[model samples]
Target: MALTTKGNLGPGRTEQSAFDAVHSAKRKDLWFAAGGLFVLAIAMSLLFTLIGDLIIRGTQYIDYDFMTSYPSRLPERAGILSAWVGSLLVMLVTAFLAVPVGIAAGLYLEEYARKGWFSDFIEINVSNLAGVPSIIYGLLALGMFVYGMGLGQTILVAGMTLALLILPIVIVSTREAVRSIPQIVKEGAYGIGADQWQVMWNYIIPAARPGIMTGAIVGLSRAIGETAPLITIGALTFIAFLPSPPVTGEFPFISFAWLHDGFTVLPIQMFNWVSRPQPEFHIAAAATGVVLIALTFSLNGIAIWIRYRLRKQHRN
Candidate 1:
C-alpha cells in the first residue's frame, strides 16, 4: 500500500481520506458484524423452516368447523371447540386471580415492606419460584387444592394452579417496572403535597405500566402453554362437555357452577393428539399448535399496542 499524507490530497478530499482510513483501521469490527449477521441468519432460517413446515402440513385441516367442533376420535372430524373454550375460561380465571394479587404483592414488596431479613428472605424465594418447573406447581396444586382442599379436578383448580405458577413472574416484573421510576419523580410528587398513595396511583403506576404489561403478557403466555400443572390438577384430556354458563334464561340466574366443572385446555388437547399413533392426528396437532401460537402472539400484540398508546398519551 502507498502511504499518503494530508498534503497529498486537496482540501475537499482530505477529510474523506481520513474517514476512509479510520474505517479501514477497524477490520476486526467489520469481521464481527459479518459473523453476527451469519449467526442471526442461521437462527432465522431454522425458525422460518419450522413455521413453513407447520403451515404446509396443517393448512388443509384448518377451517371454521375445526374451531367450533368438539374433539372426536376421528381425526377428519375432530375439532378443538371444547379445548379452546376451556382454555379461555381457565385463562380468564388465572388472569383474574393472578394479576391483581401479583401486582399487589409486587407493590407491597417494592414500596411498603421494611428492609429486613424477612423481606430479603421473601424476595429470594420469589426469585427462586420464578425458575421452578411448571410441573412442580401442578403437584403442589394437586396436593393442596385437589385432594387437600377438596376442590377436585375442576376448571377453578386448574386456573388457580396456573395463577400460582405465574405469580412470581408478575411480581418480579412489577417490582422491576416500579424500580425503574426515577426517585426524583416521586420526590417531586411529594414536594407538591401529594401523599404516598396518590403519588403511586397517579404517577408511578402510569409510568411503569409498559414494563408491567410486558411482563404480564409473557407470564400469561407461559401459563397458556403449560400442560404439566393442569395435568397434575387432573384436567381431563377427553372432556366433551362445555362448562355451564354463569347465567341462564331465568331472572337473576347467575351462577358459579361452571368453575367447578371438568375442563380441558389447548395444551392438553394437543398432547392427546400428539400421543396418538395415527398420522392424521399429528396433522391435527400441528393445526392446534398454529392456533395456540396465534392466540399467544395476539395477546402479546395487544399488550404492545396498549403500552404504545399509554406512552403516547403520557408524552402528550
Candidate 2:
C-alpha cells in the first residue's frame, strides 16, 4: 500500500506541473496579442484623425474651376491643373518603362539564373536597394540623367527616376508571388510535356499576376507622392502651361514631344503653396492635399479589386 501511494504521488505531481505550464503559456500568448492590438489601434486612430482633418479643411476649395484653371500667384485664382496633368503623364511614363523590365528581371532571377555566388550577390543588392533613401535615388538621377546623359529636367527624366526607384519593389514582389505557387503545379506542367517557357507563360505568370499588380501599384503610389527626387532633378514649381497634347490630328496621330516638356506634380505644387506665410495659400495647400489623398486611395482600390478578381478567376 505504501509503495503504491508513492507511485501515484509522482504521476499526480507530473500531471499538475504540465497543466500549470500550459496555462502559463496561454497567459503569455494572451498578453502578446493584447499588446499588438493596442499598437494597431493607436496607429489607425492617428491615421484617421489626420485624414479627417485634411478633408474638413480642403472640402471648400475642390470646385470645377479649381480643377480646370492653372496655378497663379493669387491664392483665389490658383489651381492644380498643370500639377495633376503632369503627375498623370509622369506616371504613364514610369509604368511603361518599369513594369515590363522589372517583371522580366524578376523572372530571369527566379526561373533562369543559376544558383551561385553571383546570383546571391545580385539578390542581396536588390533587397538592399529597396530600403535606400529616396534622396539617394534623387542624387543618382541628378548625376546620371540630368548631367551625364543630358536628358534635362523634363517629364522623361522624372519618369525614368521614379521607374528606377520602384524597380526593386516590383522585382521582389514578383519573385515572392512566383515562389508561393505550389511545386506540384510546376510538376504537373512538366508531366504534360510543357517546356520551361511554356510553363512560365501559361501557368506561372497567370497565377502570379495578382501579386505583381499589387506590388507595382504600391510602388507607383510611393512614387506619386515623391517630392525630393523630382525636385533634385529640377522639376518646376510654378508652371502655368500644359505639356503639348499627347494625341494629335496629324499623320502619326501621336506625339512624343511632351516627354521633353517641363513638369510640376501635385506634391511640389502643394509644397509651393504651403511655404507661403499667407493664410489663403495654406487653405490652397490643404485642398491640394485632399486631391492627392483621393488619387492615392483610388490607386489602392484598383489594386485590391484586381487582386480579388484574379484570385476568384484562379479558384474557378
Candidate 3:
C-alpha cells in the first residue's frame, strides 16, 4: 500500500484487492444514487405505519353492516351505505362522461390539430388546469352545476365536476400514449387506403389502448377520492332512507336522485363522524380511510392488470 517515486507497482495484484476496489467503488456509487430511495422508503414506512395504526384502531366500526347501511348519529347506528352507493354512481357516471371526451380531445391535439395559437392556448390552459386546486373545482361545481345550471346539488353535478377536474390529466396521458405510436403505423394504414378516421379508430387508438386505459384509470382514481366538490354541492352527511333510486317504485330496488338531491360520500361522511367529540369518530374516520384506500388500490390493480395483459398480447 506504499507509493513509489512515481507510482506504487505490485509484483502481482491480489484478486481480493482488485475485487475490493472494483466492488467497493461500485457499491459506494450505487448507494449514493440510491440514497434518495432510502429516504423515500423511510417516508413511506412512516406513512403506512400511521395508516396501519389508524386502521387497527378503527377496524371495530368497519363491519359489513356498516358498509351496507345508511349513516346515523348514534355511534352504534352509523353506516357507510348511502355514501358508498353515491360514490359508485358518481364514479361510473364520471367515467362515462369523461373518458371518451378526454381521449378525443387528446387525440385531436396530438394527432390532428395544427400547431398554432388556439392549440397552444388549449395546451397551456389544460396544463394549468391540472394544477388548479381541487377546491377551485368544488367552487366551479357549486357555481355552475348547483346554482347556475339549477341541477340542485345532486350526484350528477358532482360527477360532472370531477370529470372536468381530472380531464386534463386524462388528456395529457392519452396524448402521450397516442404520440408514442409509430408514425409508420399511420402511414401503413394510409397506404392501405384507410381514411384518417378509420386509421385512428381501427389502428391508432387500439395501438394506444394500454396507455389510454392507464390514464383513464388514474383519472378515475382521483375522481373517486374527491370530497370537496360533493361537499360543496351539500352532501348530507347523515341521510336516512338509504338514498332510494331516482326512478323506481317497483321490484324493491333502492336508487338515488340524479338531480335536486342531497347525497353523502365516504370522505364527507367520514369527516362528519370524525369531527364528533367522541373518540369513536376518529376510529370511524380511520376505518373509512382504509376503505377508500382499498378502493383506490383495487382500481389501480385492475388497470395495471389490463395494461399488462394488453402488452403481453402485443408481444405475442
Candidate 4:
C-alpha cells in the first residue's frame, strides 16, 4: 500500500502541472482579449465623439438650400451644389473606367495568364501598386495626363487618377476570391464540354461577385474621400457653375465636353472652408463633413449588406 501511494504521487503531480499550464494559457488569452477590447472601445469612442459633434453643429444647415445653392463668399449662403455635382460626375467616370478594367485584368491574371516570369512580374507590380500612396498616383496623373496628354484640370483627369489608384485593390481582391473557388468545380464544367471562357463567365464570376463587389465599393469609398490626388492634380477649390450635360440643343446634341471642364469636389470644397479664419465657415465645414461622411457610410453600408446577403445565401 505504501509503495502504490508513492508511485501514484508522481503521476498526480504531473497531472496537476499539466492542468496549471492550461490554466495559465487561458489566463493569458483572457488578458489579450481584454486588451483588444479596450483598444477597440477607445477607437469607437473617438469616432462617435466626432460624429456627435458634427451632428450637433451641422444638422441645422442641412436644408434644401444647403443642398442646392453653390458655395458663396458668405458662410450662411454657401452650399455644396457644385462640390457634390463634381464629386458625382467624377465618381461616375471613375466607376466607368475602373470596374470593368480592374475586373478584366484580375480575371486574365488568375484564369488565363501563363504561370511564367512575365505573369510573376505583373503580379508583383500590382501588389506593389496596391501599397503605393494615393498622392503618388496623383503625381503620376499630373505628369502623364495633365502635362503630357494635356487633359488639364478636368473631371476626367481626377476620375481617371482615382481609378488608377484603386485598381490594384480591386485586382488583388478578385484574385483572392477567384482563387478560393474549388478546382473541381471548374473540372466539372470542363467535363460538361464547357470552355475556359464559359466556365469563368458562368461559374467563377458569379461565385466571386460578392468579394469583387465588396472590394470595389470599399475602394470607391476610399476614392471618393480622397483629397491629395485631386489637390495634386490641381482640382479647382471654388466653382459656382455646373457642368453642361452630355446633351445640348445643337447639331451635336451628344457631347463629351463636360469631362474637360474644371471642377471642385466635396473634400476640396470642405478643405477650402476649413482653411478660412471665420467661425461660421468652420460650422459650414462641419456641415460639409457630415455630408461627406453620409456618402462614405452609405457605400460602406451597402457593401456590408451585400456581404451579409451573400453569406446567408451561401449558407442556405
Best by lDDT: 2
- List TM-score per model, in order: 0.91, 0.94, 0.86, 0.92
Residue-by-residue lDDT tens digits, candidate 3, 38-106: 999999999989888977887777888878777766767677888888788788778988999999999
Candidate 3 lDDT score at position 235:
70
The C-alpha stretches of model 1 lying farther than 4 A from their native spots are 1-25
Name the TM-score of candidate 2.
Answer: 0.94
* Alpha-carbon shift of residue 43 in model 3 (angstroms): 1.8
The better-scoring model by lDDT among 1 and 2 is: 2
Per-residue CA lDDT of model 4 for 1-316, tens digit only, reads 3456444234355687887787799999999999999999999999999999998998788899999999999988999999999999999899889888999999999999999999999999999999999999999999999999999999999999999999998899989889988899888989999999999998899888889889889889989999999999999898999987889899778988889999999999999999999999888888999999999999999999998898687657
Full-model lDDT for every candidate: 0.91, 0.93, 0.83, 0.92
Give the C-alpha miss distance for residue 63 in model 3, angstroms. Answer: 1.7
Residues 205-287 of candidate 2: C-alpha lDDT, one tens digit per residue: 99999999998998899889999999998999999999999999987999999999999999999999999998988888899
Q: All candidates: CA RMSD in angstroms? A: 4.1, 4.6, 5.3, 4.3
Stretches of candidate 2 exceeding 4 Å from the true structure: 1-14
lDDT of predicted model 2: 0.93
- For 1-316, candidate 1 gives per-residue lDDT tens digits of 9877657444465687786776687787899999999999999999999988888887788899999889999888899999999999999999999999999899889988998999999999999999999999999999999999999999899999999999999999999999999999989998999988998899889988888888887889889999999987888998777999978778778878899999999989999999999999999999998888888889889888988987798778
Candidate 3 global TM-score:
0.86
Worst 10 residues of 3 by lDDT: 252-261
